[model samples]
Target: ADSLSCVRILRKMRERVSESISKMKADMSRAEEQARREYERERRHEYDSAAYLISMNKQSAEKSKAALPHLLTMSDHLGVDLLHLSGSALSTVFDMKEMSSLKS
Candidate 1:
């Protein structure tokens, strides 16, 4: 896909992840324990699947550039302490997008 398409996909994924995390954390009146458990389970599932994808021997600074922040945020929701992966690559992808926009 083109850079613009990549950016759009990234934005959509970010919005979905943010919305899911927000809903999982909203309102904890009485069912606090239950909600916490559910959120934990969701996090584990998301993280596990992502880990599997990353392990497919295809992830790299270039190949997975657009996914760095999305993975970071998702891992954050999963409470997984992590450093920014492929950070420079992600920035390069965004920078390329900016340059492309200028030419468009």
Candidate 2:
């Protein structure tokens, strides 16, 4: 009878150990799942941020390209015309002085 009781006690102890092992495995799996989810979230955020920066750079490049022709036209019209006008004005002033000296 005593031996039978010992056998029953050992079986109970094994059953408790099995339950503890299952519980530990369940906890480890849950921790792994949580970690995976966190990593995915971080990766997704990085991808979104990189995509936004690339899109913004593309838009800025397009804006710069669109302004190229107008910038060139304006520089040609304003800058060249102003230089020409200044030269002509100086010539006219010098010619007037020469005419005055000849008259006097």
The candidate scoring highest on TM-score is 2
C-alpha positional error of residue 74 in candidate 2 after TM-score superposition, expressed in Å? 0.3
* Candidate closest to the true structure, highest lDDT: 1
Q: Could you tell me which residue pairs clash in candidate 1?
A: none
Tens-digit lDDT track of model 1 for 34-53? 44455465566466765444
What's the TM for model 1? 0.25
Q: Can you write out model 2's per-residue Cα lDDT over 14-95, one digit (the tens) per residue?
A: 3444443344335434544554565565566466766555554443344334333433343363343312233234223222
lDDT of each: 0.41, 0.40
Model 2 / residue 70 / CA error / Å: 0.4
- Candidate 2 regions exceeding 4 Å error are 1-47, 80-104
